[model samples]
Target: MSAAETTTAKVPPTRPSTAQGAGGGTGGAGKPAVRRRAGGGAALPWTLLAPCLLVLLLVLGYPLARLVALSFQKFGQPQLWGFQEPESVGFANFTKILGDGEFWAVVVRTIVFAGGAVILTMVLGMLTALLLQRVSGWVKTLINIALVASWGMPIIVATAIFKWLFDTDYGVLNWLLSRLPGVDMVGHNWFASGPQGLAVIMLLVVWGAVPFVVITLSAGLTQVPKELEEAARLDGAGSWGVFRYVTLPVLKPIIVMLTTLSVIWDMGVFPQVFVMRNGHPEAEFQLLTTYSYDKAFVVNDYGGGSAIALVTVVLLLGVVAVYMRQMLKIGEVE
Candidate 1:
């Protein structure tokens, strides 16, 4: 061969671009790297999530399992202390609770209380959030500070404050009300009637609940497009109309989330009622949580209490599932 032919022969042949392989094309050299990267990307999430999943399994999983098991068995002091083996009562406990009129009453009361509290919280929260938007910068800052302060207050402390405020004779509320013309409110026992007392507790719940809702809504409100609101205004939309058409659609998801959360929190209200009533809620004031406690610890009917608690969990789960469905529908609509 000539010198030029020899030089050409010595040069290596050009290979296909590895970009094709990286993009899952014909180039084989980059395929492994792509697979490796994709595999790592998929695995990273699970690896990061492993600790949380394990913690939940350890913390919540075992207790939940135990609760279910206890609900199915005739577990009481005897069984708890190992003096007698827990008898398998199957669905008897559930049957008893379901048949009991008192249980049904408590369930109804819980639902009503929760519904009312959630409604009040969401309204007050949304109003507060809107107010925050309209306020000056310093006023907004002060409002945010107040919201955070209230939100950070311990539930027990708040409950105690509420209890004192509603106290019969020496309460600040009665004192203030007595100051009004023709109002003889010197001594008013807020806890005399169940409805009256629950109303107070509901106020307390709403008070505590509103701060978080307000903060969440405030954050969500920031995401609302100013241009949209301006456009709405230019189109002859009144304040209510603008809010209903432009603001509400942007805020629907946040409102839904807050409402759902408020429902869960209000439904599970225990400390406020329990503490306000001095750990002994009256028959009329009894919620599902208190009732379950009464049956298990007070009445020593562990199986029945477990069943009640399980039923409550089921009810809450059902409510949450409904919320989830609504959220899914919202997602589809959006």
Candidate 2:
């Protein structure tokens, strides 16, 4: 208890570090809990998605791998039935498909058909969505019911209904058109010409596609700021100007997504064309899907058919890339 001892005695001893004490004398013990939480958070989404991924791999991945393999081999009836071993032909199938004038024609026709269908679908959908925004509540509800009903209709049933509507001999569409003064649509063969036939099919495609687009656009519309729209109008923006300057920028992402999906769906149109043409699509009526189908089943050129399908997949991947780029650009703008 001298001077130094007296000073030390008066001073209180420091307690052990609270962090270490709380962590049971191990300062870094809590780190593992944080790391585990981080890891678990990262893994949770993938764990949730694993079931869907497994199903897709089983359902779509196997067929896609088989298609890729078949495209490089001679896989006709003989090989298909095990009557003969398949011969590997390297790039022969791809070369033949790329060299074919008919294949190129089908490619161009498909692009045009899909382009038209997407354009019409977007225009009609946007107009309908805007109309919904203006209509009374009950009217809007009725329109929603109609849109959902059409969207829920099975593709086969809808195709059959369209077929009857455009039937050559007995169709309500023709009867209605004939009622127009100086118009002769009775007994008109709508499927006689390829473009005309494709146009009709395109209408059917648009009809099926528009409801989803309308619903999506309408939902997106609700997210747009009414204050921003009113501010623009007060600044002397007209209807078109307000939409162009305010509304369009806000909805650009949704519009890009809808357009891309519509393109993909329209390009892969098979059931509509196949069922409409009575399962035997004419040469003029051939899109890529139908052409590949005819090549595989009708002509028994499975390799060529697979090659065409793979090319189509490449084109669709390119479209998806465009959509991704657009979304990224929109994000940057925001």
Candidate 1 per-residue lDDT, tens place, 1-334, comes to 8999999999999876666545665766677777899999999999999999999999999988888998998988998798999999999999998999999999999999999999999989999889888889999998889988998999999998997898997899999999999998788898889999999999999999898999999999999999999998999999999999999999998888888888888889999999999999999999999999999999888888888988988988988998999899998997
What stretches of model 1 exceed 4 Å from their correct place? 1-32
**Which segments of candidate 2 are over 4 A away from where they belong?**
1-32
Candidate 2 per-residue C-alpha lDDT over 1-334 given as tens digits, one digit per residue, 9 for 90 to 100: 5999999999998988977666674556787888899999999999999999999999999999999999999999999899999999999999999999999999999999999999999999999999899999999999999999999999999999999999989988999999999999988999999999999999999999999999999999999999999999999999999899999998999999999999999999999999999999999999999999999999999999999999999999999999999899888988
Clash pairs detected, candidate 2: none
TM-score of candidate 1 against the unseen true structure: 0.91
What is the lDDT of every predicted structure here?
A: 0.91, 0.95
lDDT of 1 at 283: 100
lDDT (Cα, 0-100) at 19 in candidate 1? 66
